[model samples]
Target: MSAVPQERRLVTAIPGPKSQELQARRTATVAGGVGSVLPVFTTRAGGGIVEDVDGNRLIDFGSGIAVTSVGASAEAVVRRASAQLQDFTHTCFMVTPYEGYVEVCEQLAELTPGDHAKKSALFNSGAEAVENAVKIARAYTRRQAVVVFDHGYHGRTNLTMALTAKNMPYKHGFGPFAPEIYRVPVAYGYRWPTGAENAGAEASAQAIDMINKQIGAENVAAIIIEPVLGEGGFIEPAKGFLPAISQFATDNGIVFVADEIQSGFCRTGQWFACEDEGVVPDLITTAKGIAGGLPLAAVTGRAEIMDAPHAGGLGGTYGGNPVACAAALGAIETMKELDLNGKAKRIEEVMKGRLAAMAEKHDVIGDIRGRGAMIAVELVESGTRDGAKTPDAAAAAALAKACHQEGLLVLTCGTYGNVLRFLPPLVIGEDLLNEGLDIIENAFAGI
Candidate 1:
């Protein structure tokens, strides 16, 4: 069988005997804070399926939370990383530099938005990339306040948790977080009080006004936002919203940072989500999809702004690990060679069509949003569709459980915990894609 098989197989009940045993062991060893959606332990995963310890090959729609955009077992990524591994695992780039690090940075300069002289610093996680980006921004602008948006999620680190909006699972009890972070409204289409049509302009205007009156643009070091808010939900900002914000940052000399961690490397049918709106930021942070499932993150930006931090101010011991850098290079090559961007667009088309049909029959689907392979279906209470559009977290949860039982893997997100996000690998075949959608429809019907 290929990495992405053309069919789905069910060996036993979802969390079959083996997975159940693992689940018991995991419960005792894993921290209570750490969580997972389903209890099935995977033995191998590739293409668009995850084989559990019990031999259940589940159709994967999450793509390991959008990290494996080029496919977890992509041949190019495996080949490069394996070769690099045999040569030498870690000499530590900072201790003694490597060609892989320089080559990865070179590729980032060419691929990231804007033709301006750009430089990048690699990190091990999205949180690290985001934290470093803020550090760079503050150093460059010499300001204290950092601006984020409602329903925006940066990471779990102290500073990023301050940047993130949700308080329940992310920020609760993790208090005394990094300060100087301010939050504003995001152009969330469905939940916007006025209407979807006015959501963009209204949200943008309110955000800008709030910044001017509350935070003062002159004192803000950076205004970081996801072109498509990831964990907060796949909320694609309104049409003119991003441009307005970008222009404001330019005028104020603020370091505008686009957090493309979840939306880069052709995940949104473009090189980056900001490119969809032709809005280029002074800085861009990328991860998740960059290394074909390896832990690698980068903050790329205009050379002058990036150089704001003094010499010896950046880098970590494993910042640009040789294996991870090799994987990133391979991932980039795979994206270009296979044209995964076009595949993402096709995935979007297939998903939107099936989801629209699902919506016609199920009123719980209050909204269908997102771009390319990063699509989501917002669930709401059935009868409340004409009124407040109350969130149906229960329904979303039930549907997810139902899908898991049926050998399909789907993940839920959103501020209200009602959005079922679909992040299939770019390499997923049409048959597997449709099978997953069909499973979703059955799940909804079951609910």
Candidate 2:
């Protein structure tokens, strides 16, 4: 019951007839600002593949940017969500409250990193969770400055836009960002000015120095970082980097927040990516993989810090909708019963093995990084294999287009737009995963 029928059957052309017609309709109705990587429209999605309106089955390499880790149509999610739908939809937790909402918080408290006394507050999305975490941190420390890494992506909201690092599509033209936000260096191994071996210590030292000189530690409320950067590329922070930052935050009385929106819930072979380095943050923000594709997010933290905000200062109308809570419960149960963490680790072995063999032949692949199912390959100029790396954004785009044409869905990201990320569902079948990788290999060969 945990598995979906594993196959990559193409019924028509990549976009086919029906999808093309819908694409035309979408062009007229959808906002010009909103963008989709592929022009095709999805009708059904589950383990391994998403079926388009034209009946083309494309292998899924992007789980809605790491949302559906339990697969899109997981049986438990469907069952629990269906029962809740029949009972009652929205009573507003702030008005009457519900057991489902409390249960989700209980799960968050138990599942998030740190064995210390913990508490949680649910929200509707990752961005909301992040914003709330910041609120709690500032209130707890009675400080104004919030520090974030150079390549981290928080959200699209105005305050989060200020928190985010990128300037193109995410932050461009959206000005007057929130105040008291400062940018610092992240331990990106591939692009560090120093060599990869020195990335951790060097980056940490530089970050701490900046915090002390430019922004006093006493004025800082929190230090937020993504253990594995997502939209900025699937860059896993260099080993020892996170631990160093965590210690510095502790010494300065600054709340450390691990943004695990895209790296949590077994997506990285661990419940939380920070756990890999034993970097237990005072606060952890989660979404994306929390509720089996439903909208749900949470900020779990030490009880003392989380309680800093008054009752009326937190919560929203749809913070923990009963249906979403039901889906989250089902997703957690499915992750445990299916042992998704083990699956993610196994997938890392399979994918990294295949990608390494390919890298041996292809020089354009400048780097291979990330943990478990959440992985990426950085593409650079084909000839600069041993020289200064030059990003190959064109090659990344071309590879993704080639994969789409062959019924394999892939996504491109990174500050340089040179990273081809892979986020296959943990429940995907081995045959399907290898087949998808084969398509990627073939695309690279053609390139």
Collision count for each candidate, in order = 0, 0
Report clash pairs, candidate 1.
Answer: none
Tens digits of per-residue lDDT for model 2 on 99-134? Answer: 999998898888888889998999999999999999
Compose the digit string of candidate 1's lDDT tens values, residues 44-75. 78888888898889988998999988877889
- In order, candidate lDDTs are 0.92, 0.92
Error of 2 at 306 (Å): 0.8
Candidate 1 overall lDDT versus native: 0.92
Candidate 1: Cα lDDT at 241: 89
